[model samples]
Target: MTEPVDEGLVIYWRPLCGFCQRLLEALEVAGIQATLRNIWDDPEAATFVRSVNDGAETVPTVVVDGIVYTNPPPDQLVIHLQQA
Candidate 1:
């Protein structure tokens, strides 16, 4: 059987994206601390982000441990964090 993805609460976001802004706000309100990687500052990261999402660099993609949450909501994200 295939093992489940274990994404561990790391968020990749862009400054211009409103969804990213909301996600950050939600994290703050929920008192959650997540490592954020901005694609603009790091060119290599932009490439890596694309690789993670099948060549589509989607903002607000979160990695909780190994699994990826492509645009996860705040409540769902909290639940995921609780699992860790």
Candidate 2:
């Protein structure tokens, strides 16, 4: 079994996705630490994203404190981070 990531946000994304890039930049600007998992590089990350998104490999799939968010806006993500 794979070891769980117990801290920080896990970001499942693709390299060419503009939204993914934007979100990463926003997280950086907000000083939020995130673990970036490129879907194209990691099959497990892609599978996890697909599992959350109706079997579709959706980019910008973020996991925060065990909650999944698909394409969430930067402000919303920051809110969640703040709450955490």
List candidate 2 segments past 4 Å from native. Answer: 1-4
In candidate 2, how many Å is residue 29 off? 0.5
Please give the lDDT score at residue 54 for candidate 1: 85
Please, what are the lDDT tens digits per residue for candidate 2 over residues 1-80? 23325565898899889999989998998889888899899988887888788989888988887778899998888877
lDDT for 12 in candidate 1 is: 82
RMSD of each: 4.6, 2.2
Stretches off by above 4 angstroms in model 1 are: 1-8
lDDT of each: 0.76, 0.83
| TM, every model | 0.80, 0.88
